[model samples]
Target: MATTSFGAMRGLLNVKFFQTNFSAMEHRSDIKKDNKMKEFQRILKSLYENLIMLELYPRSQIDLQVFVLESDGSYKSAAFNAVSLALMNAGIAMKDYLVATTSGLINNVAVLDLIYTEEKKQNCEFVMACFSQSKNIAYLSLNCNKINAKDFKNLVEMSQGSCDQISQ
Candidate 1:
């Protein structure tokens, strides 16, 4: 679903996404010109900033190139996983494995790793990433019209469980 390359270059943390068509169709351009793509890039960069030990490489830059070959729903999570593994492979210093997952309430039931269709069917959605070893949250985003406390709690639990599974 995703592949990434990690390099030490000249800027801080620079992340670029390629094959826009495969990830999500957008206007044909040499670079991703869509607002959604830019937002995705920002979110991914923030996620990396949270997990990576940036202080260790003060003068060096961390360059990550992510190519998304396919996506249904939760492609950002795939990107997170890809970059995390690539960082480890490249021997970059990281606090921990940043495992991510998307979960939502479908008919008031917690569901994990929803597909495109399942995403539409869900009432509320949450994207979360955490330090797998420490079980500490690194990032969390929510999108829901309205949800009760019980349902929200269940969704968080489900999301964390899925992240743990992915980490393994």
Candidate 2:
């Protein structure tokens, strides 16, 4: 029997920008923005290095999966949000593409991306997968019972928005 094991790593980005009354008069906003940009760059750099290392494995093929434990609006969309940036940093070639995003139906309304609270109240949940570069859907999975065809179509459209933002 041949066994294949998958290894996973988790990364966190907790950035806090506090404003003191005294410093608010100064360049506090500018300072905070600069720090945020630096943090974003660091995250992209780390993800790129990790993906590159995964490519070094001798396996004939490898699958990279990313999960977002915390999200405000674009939960699934945020999962691989940094992946393209990382891939660009590492200079990896991809025949196809990978994109992910979350959707929820709340109060009979289909929302593109739901925060934690909205997700709690929603009756339906969906995760849409697509090609990162070509903007083609690969798969869609719905939780909290099955959804109708119309709702499914809406989910695809909303999820596509997420993919488009990431591609740019």
What is the number of backbone collisions in each predicted candidate, taken in the order shown? 0, 1
lDDT of each: 0.78, 0.56
Candidate 1 deviant stretches above 4 angstroms:
1-11, 22-33
lDDT of 2 by residue, 8-125 (tens): 2322222222223342222336667467446544543443433344433433333333433333544334545545544556555545446677888997788876776787789898
User: Which number leads on lDDT?
Assistant: 1
TM-scores of all candidate predictions against the true structure: 0.79, 0.53
Candidate 2: which pairs clash?
77-101
TM-score of 2: 0.53
Prediction 1 TM-score vs. true: 0.79
Question: Model 1, range 67-101, lDDT digits (tens) per residue?
Answer: 77766777767777888999999999887879888
Candidate 1 clashing pairs? none
